[model samples]
Target chain A: MQVHVEVLNFYARQMRLLDALDVEGYAGTFTEDGVTDHAHRGERVEGRAALIAGAKLALPRYAGAAVRHWNDHYLIEEVDENTLAVSYCSLVTRTDADGNVTFEPTFAIEDVLVRLDGELYTRSRTIHRDRPAAAA
Target chain B: MQVHVEVLNFYARQMRLLDALDVEGYAGTFTEDGVTDHAHRGERVEGRAALIAGAKLALPRYAGAAVRHWNDHYLIEEVDENTLAVSYCSLVTRTDADGNVTFEPTFAIEDVLVRLDGELYTRSRTIHRDRPAAAA
Candidate 1:
């Protein structure tokens, strides 16, 4: 089956916006009433305003840090015209102040994606199967 | 606008199989030519035999570990009849030998799902936004 390149590009753009901490671009990835759950803070920021505000707050804390993340072992269990459910593993890395690089453990992430207004937006997500310190 | 429950159910079953260490049920999630990257082991297991073998090896090591994984903040960027790209975050917990539980930092997972031979499987993944304990 042929995969849609547009879908891949959309996801890639979202990643780039996040990596660059582009607050505006980041907020653009969602709908007007989109919701975000920053699990680390145990907080869920809803709607575009809150999402943008949260990203603005986060950009500075990670000012000097560079991040690298990738997903492998993806299983596209099902698909339809408007929605999709996807599961995959993610590996992440962060660079510290002392120039020491660290890798976060790998984990499983499952998501439900919905097409709204001719754009792709996240509806819900579930993250599981994390093995921390795998790089340590 | 409508979400496919079967896809979610499939993901739930996959996780349940992993939690229970049910190799048979776990392996059923992949295709015959499926390949898995054992990040902890730093290797890739391809084909059904290797996939099963790798699972057998790792399941025992995680015997007593308790895990609960859920994805929230789903961004389904694009979904066609057979292909999809999704991004989401994950939270994970692990119980140690001492019975102490630790929550690893959250991670963002990006996946591309493809339909093949009447089954949906993952084609590629890119992980981003991994927050480690030090940064958290």
Candidate 2:
């Protein structure tokens, strides 16, 4: 029970750091060799530095807009003794000054987090959007 | 241990049935009122009967082509005592007559499976592909 809460808190903390534009802190949640797979666009960023760089480029698209990622319906699978597979439907919303949606609101993310010592750090992250592909 | 194997087999059998064009058999894996959300296309098919209908419409697109669905990196989460959430990367490949690749290979799927009467059946399944959105 405590472990579950801690894990959920870890996820929330990562999102909160991003919301606060704490890129470095966000990147700290990953291991030194973490990987990010932007599956929605077929791009993979390897290593912690690359993952942080990718986030730096992507997270600021809504510079003047408010971006909120709502995640729920999480499935947490302990793939092995140490690795965890987590999935959730993340509704990412970007709103303007007038409260109008600035971008698509349906987003999802799946991740493989590994336990290092007693702490959990992400190993690989996959992203998705609930929209049609630009190309078939 | 037994439970894990059953869940994994559940996924494998569904793919096998699809590979064999056994829509009916594949549909049987779902509960009576299951929901399938193809997040890539922003479409949802509800209920076993409707799911079968949808599969019938989509599976034949590979009639003259060979389709292989490679699923791995599974993350399974037990949402509650009775409900389980499973996440995995499903790479689907379609080969032409000359055995050349025809479609994108990286596909991701997340599913909610429920335990009923000691057996597992999928309650909801969501799919996403890492690519730009096509004009809907």
Candidate 3:
């Protein structure tokens, strides 16, 4: 399979696990020492264990909501034989039990993915909240 | 490139043209006699000219908003050597100048895409608005 399709498919599966609140499953999509940097919040989470811990700690915020990460404009680059760099825009939505939908600020995400034993896993991710363009 | 990647890239470009309100450019992504069936509204628009005309009529709805269609869970089936059946869920968002986001009802869309001279184009599309699932 081509890197573009592979990377897109990887995100589709990984994000589903996260949106479903499957912390362990979601963390499994990453390497054992994966890192996630929330640039806008100045938080850096290192390792799958830490990732799961952080996810669990934030689970309560989604108590009665179905959360989805709607992504677009995926740009994928093959960094080398076994690594790929990918970036995309993400718009998050939370639909409550009563069918009311709310939005979190949109974000732009960059990820480095590596191939391990022919399977893809996220090595690192950096997220930046989107802001309006400054006046020129 | 594989069919999966080709289809995804086709959508990325097509959606961009659509969200930009470039009605003529958007219609050009379809075949000369392409058809769009709004199943929920019982409206059928046939051919590129009709598509452009219909889109122009709806342009005023997006007067001061940036419209976006965020799609996910693409299922692609090769119908034959040169045809593909694709389906996905779409969530529409309209962001006003001030960045307040509003949503249109979500939709499930099915499309038939055909490869002509090695490039893919939409042959037909059917859209259905999403609704709450009924309890058993």
Candidate 4:
């Protein structure tokens, strides 16, 4: 069973883009018609344009805040040759207005990804098992 | 490009168990060595026995709570023949101590799944965005 190295690299790149708050690179991770459903925010931004806009809106809110977020512990339930369902844990670190750094852990992000033109792009994502204390 | 149907079925069943809070059924989804990292709970339960135990501990706390959880909008990125990454969103319904039901939306979940022994299992996962708001 050979694991897909590209998928791992993709995830790693995503982490870097997000950590750096590079909205363009983050938006590039999706397809042109990609959709992002933010359950907690109660907003769904569809298409590359809107997705980019959302990223631009949110990325800077935390400016000057030290943050590190990573996810590991994965489960991939294949939906088909072109699709997959995955879930994992996410840990977040950030410095507050008081200059206190906080660590927050959350659970099981469920997502469905599709392969388009031999490139993997996100279609949708949902988050579960989030607690305030977990967010630290 | 043939999608793996069995994997989809497994994930669908797992989601059903979670929405229903069927502990036994939920525990049945993983292999004997399966583990769940409850990042929010800050606990990692390894193997089927521990997984079941953890579910048993948490299920009751959700009793009497109106629970609604659903997964949709799949974005799958194939890394190779045997590995994949995905992200998706979840919508949840909960009831408070006062019996008030609230629906909360969450962030997208990202994960990496590996196929082992002709079966797909979670290798790594990350929760990128998670937010919960008042019931709509």
On TM-score, the candidate that comes out on top is 3
Winning candidate number (DockQ): 3
lDDT of 3 by residue, B1-136 (tens): 4887888888987987887788999999999999999999999999999999999898878786667788889999999999999999998877665657778999999999999999999999999999788987
Share of true Cα-Cα contacts across chains kept by each model: 0.00, 0.00, 0.11, 0.00
Candidate ranking (DockQ, best to worst): 3, 1, 4, 2
Ranking by TM-score: 3, 2, 1, 4
TM-score attained by model 4? 0.50
Candidate 1 scores a chain A TM-score of 0.72
TM-score preference between candidates 1 and 3, better one: 3
Give Cα distance to truth, residue A78, candidate 4, Å.
3.0
Write candidate 2's Cα lDDT for B1-136 as tens digits: 4455677788888888877778898888899999999896799999999998888888768778878776644556678988888876554567789878654424557899998998788899899654322221
Window of ten residues with lowest summed lDDT in model 1 chain A:
A127-136
* Docking quality category of candidate 1 according to DockQ thresholds: incorrect
lDDT-wise, the better of 1 and 4 is: 4
DockQ of 2: 0.02
lDDT of 1 by residue, B14-45 (tens): 65565556677767776666666534335666
* Least well predicted 10-residue stretch by lDDT in candidate 3 chain A: A127-136
Candidate 4 per-residue lDDT, tens place, B18-132, comes to: 6557666776655566666645546667777777677778766676553545455666778888776756776554644343545554646665666777766656445434646
lDDT of 3 at A18: 88
Best prediction by lDDT = 3
DockQ for each model: 0.06, 0.02, 0.13, 0.05
Which digits, one per residue and each the tens of the lDDT, describe model 3 over residues A3-116?
A: 776777898999999899999999999999999999978999999999999999999999999999888968777899999988777888899989998887666689999999
Give per-residue lDDT, candidate 3, residue B28: 96
